[model samples]
Target: MSKGFSKEFLWGGAIAANQSEGAWDEDGKGMSVADVIKFHSKIYVKDYKKQMEITSQQIEEAIKDKSEKKYPKRRGIDFYHKYKEDLALFAEMGFKTLRVSIAWSRIFPTGEEEKPNEKGLEFYEELFTEMKRLKIEPIVTLSHYEMPLELSVKYNGWEDRKIINLFVKYSKTCFKRYKNLVKYWLTFNEIDSIERHPFITAGIIPEQCKNIKQSIYQAFHHQFIASALVTQECHKIIPESQVGCMLTKLTTYPNTCNPEDVEKTLIKNLLNYFPADVQVFGEYPVIIQNMLEKENIIIKKESGDEDILKNNTVDFVSFSYYMSLTESANENSEKTAGNTIFGVKNPYLPSTEWGWQIDPKGLKISLLELYDRYKKPLIIVENGMGAVDKVETDGKIHDDYRKEYFKKHFEQMKEAIEMGVELFGYTSWAPIDIISAGTSQMSKRYGFIYVDQDDYGNGTLKRIKKDSFYWYKKVIESNGEDLE
Candidate 1:
């Protein structure tokens, strides 16, 4: 049998409202950047068609680069309307907690509203109430890259200092409304990735903001301030609640055992953790400040920004560990394709159909490293494999591969906990398959319960249990003992 977890171990599923909830325009909700992008196939196919217009031979080259998401996935999996049913399913899976985001636009309607939207506020009130009815705790993210589109157009997104205050107002509103329902709060989802890929994540192109460095620095600064302010607000409003930060943990591996390669890998790994360290630890890493100065990018520290971070330090460090990468200064090294800008292939690990490296051990290492550096409880907010599935004649999906994927990761996670890592919990990327973030397609399924939807967006929105569903249920029921 697997090693049993602590008595307080939390098991649950995670999803963002924008990623799962379709009613983008319903209940006075405002539009987000996710509303514009099409699915992965449409993007790749269109690119392919364009390349072929230049030369027929370019088809091969275009196809190589065309991964997925030709268009934004259909207004998500309709979770806005189906959250009741979805939550029921999660309850069936024995979810002790459900990690979801409150759509920022839903509350503010416009990013800079002095008054909050009552309808948006009421919707989440009902949502959290339902979770409480089901005895499932809610782990809520204040901002999950769903910045109001109006904010982007008017003030260039987070570039202006005004956003810091606006974000705090929005966060405070939620805290007061749902203080009893949600004990776990996160300032932002994957803020580091948003800082890294502002255009894709938030539609704020760096070129439009004076310069690339200025745009990124400004975005990071605004988010850090927002986080700090939100943490402070949460304490005053919900003093007993635990607040933390979410990062997309893209772990790095050395290209080789050589000393130079190992040194480079160490530096690359530090880059991933540096963003969280600055926010959670309240001081920017020496290496990060050195690099910023070398690049001549001065980060303007607002009055009290340092105090905000220091006094409002996060209670935990939560991260999404998807896969690991290997980096080299060598220009000709093979490039790995995935969601993040820093993503690269690890020569030692196998890759998914989408070219994402699969290394369960990397998850263990990432957990240990974060705990070692931060000395705070670590919550794995997201981790899973996205792959293609085939439905057999019996109308069942025998996804043994996904089960194996979770098995290996759980084994390593158990080891990490044994190593003295204060792990809070582990939640799969999505309990139910929704839209793929990078490609914006539903075909790249990652859910235990598969929704019968396709690339063209046809089907009954039916939820079918994959083989992994039963496997995961047992894993939860036994609290990891079934894994062994």
Candidate 2:
């Protein structure tokens, strides 16, 4: 009934290297910020205040604790060793693209290194070549919630202006090395999340800072300059390539029709949109600037920072949409949490096993709002439900709920295109199950292909295709024409 997806629309899945690759210290790989993060119970997921305050003492203790059981991210699903088989499975699923992040510590070892580790570069080279051979285009994220642990411990993350150059060095090496194999690049994963989880997002240990707010904003400034600088270098190295900024598209709905509630919702949405607005429009929105001033936060900027941001804006905008948040003006309102965001509960919507509210229409709203705001090509880089999957006696998984979730979201995506949104691609959160980002558990699965692993890091590490795997294969094979 409507004009369908474009001929070259990218359809695939995405996984961060630190979340999927196990060999945390193999082949010259150094410890990343992700490696030292411990696996907390479900109760800690919503205690953002405590999580954000990661101290140096905690880091020292985590480094000494030689238990993979406590630190599941230290040993990811071993994608460092099993990428070939995984890519083969993705290719069999008719994936047109695969979104992956290059571990910064793998290449730089430490943020101060002048030369990259040749072994680290060699590994990604082999990985990308195989993807190219299978005709699978690679969309790479330069920094995806993982930076050198040494950076945070020694330099206090991106707060120091010198981190700009360090990040640029890492970016230049990647741009020059993998220019042939990858064309699409994202500067940062969820650049807006630094305030929520400073350690994971920007390698900042909040407990070390006297004024965390000031440090956070200063880091944001450095990252903005770094993103712009890398974007400029990416163009110089790969003339035909495209670069984008990724954000957590936090959609908010007013709890009621009251004008005050609507105003509160507007302000809440701006908090999440601030970073993306800078990357896409090349300047901070006036409201955000005013908010910073009110908070007494002064961001130290270099001489040409304005010029760099203005001259080199992103080519497209990518985002991860998992849930919609409800907002109310009432101070004492019922609240809930979802994948790095908090909001009031919407009674009409259901939640996943992990408490992330499911709102398929929210994806449509995000696409429409983003298109209207930026007028640039949009890509949904991550969107999937995490659930505790059970295998029947026959060794086959029947995950109809997961299938329904994607089907509804895919329908909304198609409707968005019909309404004149210029979408470039859609890569689901993960093609294969990896360690959970929040809880660091392998049991919280969100993949068409399941990895045989558990919370205690025990299993054969075998790959089994769920029923949704076959269903998604047909969807990709038909170019989103078939849903059932």
Name the regions of candidate 2 deviating beyond 4 angstroms: 44-48
Candidate 2 per-residue lDDT over residues 8-29, each given as its tens digit:
9999999999899988888888
Model 1 C-alpha RMSD to native: 5.4
Candidate 1 error regions (>4 Å): 1-4, 42-74, 200-203, 342-344
Give one digit per residue, the lDDT tens place, for model 1 in 298-364.
Answer: 8888787788778878999899987888877665677765444444467688988877789999988
Whole-model lDDT values for every prediction: 0.79, 0.91
Among these predicted structures, which one has the highest TM-score?
A: 2
TM-score of each: 0.92, 0.98
Error of 1 at 39 (Å): 2.2
TM-score of 1: 0.92
Query: Candidate 2: lDDT of 171?
Result: 93
